[model samples]
Target: MVSSPSATPASALSAHAITAHMGPCAILHDIHLALAPGRWTSIVGPNGAGKSTLLRVLAGLQSCTGSVQLLGRALADWPRRERARTLSWLGQNESAADDLTVYDVAMLGRLPHQAWLAPPSSADHAAVEQALRATQAWDWRTRALGQLSGGERQRVLLARALAVQAQVLLMDEPLANLDPPHQADWLLLVRELVARGHTVVSVLHEVSFALQADDVAVLAAGRLRHHGSTQDAASHRALEQVFDQRIAITQAAGMWLALPRLERPAAPAPSAAAPVSA
Candidate 1:
């Protein structure tokens, strides 16, 4: 189900013959993919399958052997500041200074839009407020990042990414430390982004959540196994095969869920008859 570049000239993002190496080990093989505009795509795979690596390459934050196009133009050709303005990235467990206020942390996303040594504009403040509210972290705007719980920190970081207001967002393990309700909130946020014609690419370990994306990209051993609509049979087969069929994809409550295919624990052996008689 690999998407052909020829079919999508105006893709939001496209990679061709991408290969990445970490030291002497090749982490990602040749991968060709094109992600549609105004859509959400989730990358899912087993550990060490290069999901994060692929995302880094897409963000132009990692060195790879192939070319990536952003908005139909060569990624490498874009100026650094311009590229930063066009793409926002949220990495797993991203760290910020503990003493920085939540609002200050989110303001970091506005750097690309500001001139050298210039102060944040009114628009910058507005964007940060909107982003913080979107993540439900506005009430803690004045609080230090260190004072918050892990989930709270995650939401603030998400706010920072959103404040960039980029055309495309690349998030890796964005759901880390989030509770179920917050995770559901993230789902709704992504939908809102897509509806506005923004492109979102996320690496999600939660397969059920991944299925909620418009498309799924399943990888294995650093190779692209499949990239297609979430409802496509081929995509489902690839998912099942990649995880060794230890999970079953089923429909429940009008949404897809990837349930584990494990047998119930065997009942404990009955106590000795002598103990019962006593």
Candidate 2:
């Protein structure tokens, strides 16, 4: 389903002067960022900071004021079919018809590759099989989506996205409703994609998970506060400032961990040196 560009660019994605509004309430303000090819970038922010909104704008799912470029071309200039083949989006709480089998749901990703009203080719079948197996969702291929648990359904959705085999992938809050082990599996999947020369952008609420990304973009109050390499001191400072220093960062086992600062009761001050009037 992925589109092969005539030529690849130095940066896979870029956004400039993006501002989005929902019903006259601004959600993002003058955002500018560029994502490198074949790298993983995570967007992190406090709730209501418009992290997801910014992602939508980049994906062309949301109308906003600004320009987003993909593969050295303006995003708006791409044909719809070509765009679909070049970018795959996995949004939060994605839902499909409850009666659709997992296989059928995942096979929908092949739409971009299929001729209209034509039967799926062997290529489509192969892609779906690989995707399902990758996510370990093959075991339930014939099961209807409604029959699966939230985590299981999430896996199926992820498989569908993987089946697209896009050059650039965007996911919004993909970790929601996943257990710790499954979350780790998702992380591995992302790394494997990046290693294979796919660019990935995800919006993550988990600061620790975001820290594992190659780069992080921090947003606060609908504005971009910082965008830099994850290990950079400037990025860490932006994170703390955005969160009002409620969390602390510690490096352990070659990874950064975000832990909340536990509030403790203040001790009473001794009665003002008991007024021994000098």
Q: Please report the candidate that would top TM-score against the real structure.
A: 2
lDDT of each: 0.94, 0.92
Candidate 2 pairs with clashing backbones: none
lDDT of 2 by residue, 53-101 (tens): 9999999999999899998889999998878888999999899999999
Candidate 1: segments with Cα more than 4 A from true spot: 1-9, 264-278
Per-residue lDDT of model 1, residues 11-96, tens digit only? 89999999999999999999999998889999999999999999999999899998999989999999999888889999988999
RMSD versus native structure for model 2? 4.3
Query: Which candidate number maximizes lDDT?
Result: 1
* Cand. 1 Cα-lDDT: 0.94
Tell me the spans in candidate 2 whose CA falls farther than 4 Å from its real position: 1-6, 264-278
